[model samples]
Target: MHYESPVREPLVIGDKTYHDITRDVARPIETTAPKMWWIAFSIAMAMFLWGVGGILWTIANGIGSWGLNKTVGWAWDITNFVWWVGIGHAGTLISAVLLLFRQKWRMSINRSAEAMTIFSVIQAALFPVIHMGRVWLAYFVLPIPNQFGSLWVNFNSPLLWDVFALSTYLSVSTVFWYVGLIPDFAMIRDRAVNPIQKHIYKILSFGWGGKVKHWQRFEEVSLVLAGLATPLVLSVHTIVSMDFATSVIPGWHTTIFPPYFVAGAIFSGFAMVQTLLIITRKLFNLEDYITIQHIEMMNIIIMLTGSIVGVAYITELFIAWYSGVEYEQYAFLNRATGPYWWAYWSMMTCNVFSPQFMWSKKLRTNLIFTFIISIVVNIGMWFERFVIIVTSLHRDYLPSSWSMFSPTAVDIAFFLGSIGFFFVLFLLYARTFPVIAQAELKTILKSSGEKHKKHHSDDNHGHH
Candidate 1:
């Protein structure tokens, strides 16, 4: 018997054209029936509200509301700061590194990921700003030559470097993301159902008519932006790592941190991508575009980067022992056997052991399993940062300095609130813009048709 084709609807090949494909997918990652728009709008608004509420509470109270003490000064705040920053790295990586390598997959996800990078960085920025007991004087972190006092923002401070590095990264990444949106925004502007959306898109598009010269110039600027962003991604994480690595803190000091942190940034960043996209594709009804193949590909990256992170963990443990530095060795030992040993082990289990399961082909293809693993990876990475920061600092050299840290109610609430913030922003994004990159999707469709034609022609040649 002839094998039945798996194909259902035979999409009108080339009839849609590259421009048509880009126009449709540019609205949302998935298409909603006219009836579904209300549901999408309501959900997005609710999440945004919760996020706002959480931030307000943080401002009204103080950092004292967190799980911090004099002995254990860092806790969830710093862990989350690093985690969000790491998540931001994936944005630039997808847009920048992939462009340099000429990878097309970057096209499909880069817009959303870049937006994710900007929003996550915003969330990450909130921590350092509000973590200051005097949130009113956040300007103190900025290095403006002030005549107000002798207090110059110390050039020698890594915190100051972080201020410069993060500001530059945020500004550049935001511009890059917005610039890429121009053509797509033009599509939305033309197809817009109402005057409001049309006006918004018109302004955003800045008057593009999809001219060839426009695409040409757009591509050139995108390339330059990608080049700038590649270093920006590497530098931001390295600088964040240096905030600790440059320190006298035993577990925090090591040359391994820069690259190690970059790898971890990519790992956690991908996990957040998977988490958001998995839900996004479903909600928007764009299964054909996102595809099971896409998730599998991401799973492979998650496993690879996660393994790199695991190796970093093992290397740190080995180096701690080999270096024969009592402080470093003791820090590692304390992580494994001390008061927060559970946190340490939980991190290893989630980040190291859980993602290793993706090595099995069967599991990688299982969406439910991959989703669970994504959550596990996120949790593991968060705890990894927490354990690194808290365990080493809680017990300094002297016993008199040793103390345990636990997050208070406010800390727990604020952490939970930021998740709401991220999702809220993402939910709004899903509604306002296309969840899937339409322009990028057109490239894949072109590639797919070419593959099918090639195979069909080969079959005829073999028969001849």
Candidate 2:
């Protein structure tokens, strides 16, 4: 077993040097794609449209058009909401968490992960809005000093807290992402020959030259943002858990939910990143920059978090049984032996059992298997949330009040449509952005901090 060191050393380049990203590694970044990618992109686009049509259908008809019944009022919408939100976690972790740790490899993939955060957040924000059913009056969730009265927003409600927390988290993440893009924008801006492209990038670069002092301060601000975002990532997911844990429901009342949810978020988020990266590294011809080493490192994380998530599941069941709380025990048992057995077992197989394969390097390192496992992990995660939200609520207390709810056609379409929505945006992003962050890539190329390498930035960079 190799103990991979985490230290990074800076690399210095003379002011006159020109970077040749194409020749930086064994493989060129411009990949020759098979026709299938176009087909896939098209299909994803169609899915996004169909998903939108479903949303529109719900809007026209009503929120009651879907399968959410009295008992399971928060079925698919909340499930999808948490799932997408969880998926957003890994991006912040990759960009913010690793940056604080000074993990240089993060540079090569951080931009894509940041884009994932932005896109996933977009996908996530849709659920709360659409789940409101009236869609148009969904603004009711927003707090405005109303003509009805001076009654303020509910400071007491977690859902209201969600309104505040999610918006703040999303806004901060977006700004941090855009700020990081400035230097990279300058690179592309300087390289662009097309008049229109040059104009767009010129405004974006904000007259950033490669000035040494500017680079120094840029580094400082980037680090500061990284520090802020790291905690925000944890806090955001923890708040999402509060939406559940703060409740009185048997399974929902556990103290474990926050960390468990956070771990699950990172677990699923990384799996999503892996899914995109596997295709991205190949499609963008970024194998050299992304490297097998990069994949292996991520696999290690997937394994660790996948295992952590598995433990959370088991721990939940165990605590329920151990606490001697009839309600809690029954909540879990109902999940396994009750009507939702299929969903429960599916979650276990996808999240718990599949990741066990990664314990073996041969399995984790296999490109196809890794990708398939990543997909399975995501599926398991979605089901885990579904089982948690729906199963627990579907038959809460009092058997007389117990009921079942299956999603309507609208629910199915909207759910699948969001998948399309996420991918469609992602595909377009890949085509337009560097996909691999050039500036961050330079940071990675710097020496191992263990080796204590000297560093330098170009004089042609940001303004003095």
Candidate 3:
């Protein structure tokens, strides 16, 4: 029943077999850590420790440790939150949305993308919690009963909706991720020579024996979850957009925010995925499994989303000018020409202009160019959030309140620390977990694997 068009390139290159797939995937976990892994881990660990120090400093010193001023109340914290959250969007899109569409290419990269989603969402969640200053009072954001005179969370607040949206997204994504891991865990369990390893994977695998019923249920649950998660990929970021759109602030208030934010999220999320997958393929020597076809496929998505983001940018400017509201127009103008103009232009160059290069088939398919563009797109995304959040708030209605914002060392540390922490989690996951879904990849081996394609071609040549 498995069929792939002959014109389509093979997904799994280099004549890989099922056994080879399992061995290559399990190698990192079974073998001793390579020196490069150790070196990378040490660097990431150092960065994470430095970030931890910054978090501790903030906790000890309060919000005063940041560079937030009266005019710019929300700065790096919100920017980073949105950026991380945006990055988190790609995982579910890759896993859930693509699954619903029955895209087989997802099988290779979906595992790591899901991990990235969970880890990045964790990083995004940290900012709002830390921004609370009184971290103990963070529980108040939740609706649980407290001793504070029966006070409840405000239902109207978009922030509360974020709590619901982000938590739901995380829960579903985690379940979806773990469910996919079960069969792979069982693979490792069966392969384990060490009793302790076997015992651990046994529990992790949940007694999966590759029964027909097991697969049937797995497919059912995955379809159900994908259906559930598909809406989330859109809803979560839409609610996030409401955080800005609901506000009455000039640049902040707009109907375009929801779609704009969602597109930007996908744009940046794919870029991060590209960054992670490229590095992963290099480090793990998974070039055959994670092929150029996969890279080109991802690049196509990046290009599409990046174009959508660019259009959103222009739409925002048009709306600002067309709205006839002086403040709104001024906000957009200031973004490009004000003190923060550099950030705005950086966003433009990175986000708006860079992805245009993907139009070239040669460039999008080229590994090195793709990697560079991926980093560029992420940088642009960060700047985009900064421009949107800061530029809007820095200038108020009254001239007296207008002031520029700057980040203190603590602010920089927290941002760098989050990056460190993200990589720390990803590195550990890459080493321990099956970074690629071997079970799923096996299903498509006959249809899209290189060996099968070679055979098909040879048969056609013989008939000719």
lDDT of 3 by residue, 94-136 (tens): 9999999999999999999999999999999999999999998
Q: Point out where model 1 deviates above 4 Å.
A: 1-54, 149-151, 449-464
Candidates' lDDT values, in order?
Answer: 0.80, 0.81, 0.93
* Total colliding residue pairs, candidate 3: 0
- For 48-158, candidate 2 gives per-residue lDDT tens digits of 999999999998998888898777889898999999999999999999999899776787788889899888988888998987767777667778866678767778888
lDDT assessment of candidate 2: 0.81
Models 1 onward score TM values of 0.90, 0.90, 0.98
Off by over 4 Å in 3: 457-464
Error of 2 at 57 (Å): 1.0
- Residue 372, model 3, lDDT: 98
> All candidates: CA RMSD in angstroms?
4.6, 6.1, 1.2
Per-residue alpha-carbon lDDT of candidate 1 for residues 1-464, written as tens digits (9 for 90 to 100): 21212232221233445665665576463345444546654665565566566567778776666778888888888888999999988889988998998765566677778889998998899888878878888898886767687768889989889999999999999998888887677777887777887888889889989788988887899899999889889999999999999999999999999999999999999888888778776765555556666677788989999999999999999999999999999999999999889999999999888888889989998888888888889999899899889998999989998998877667766676677677667766777776555654564554453344454456668998
Instruction: Give Cα distance to truth, residue 149, candidate 2, Å.
Output: 1.3
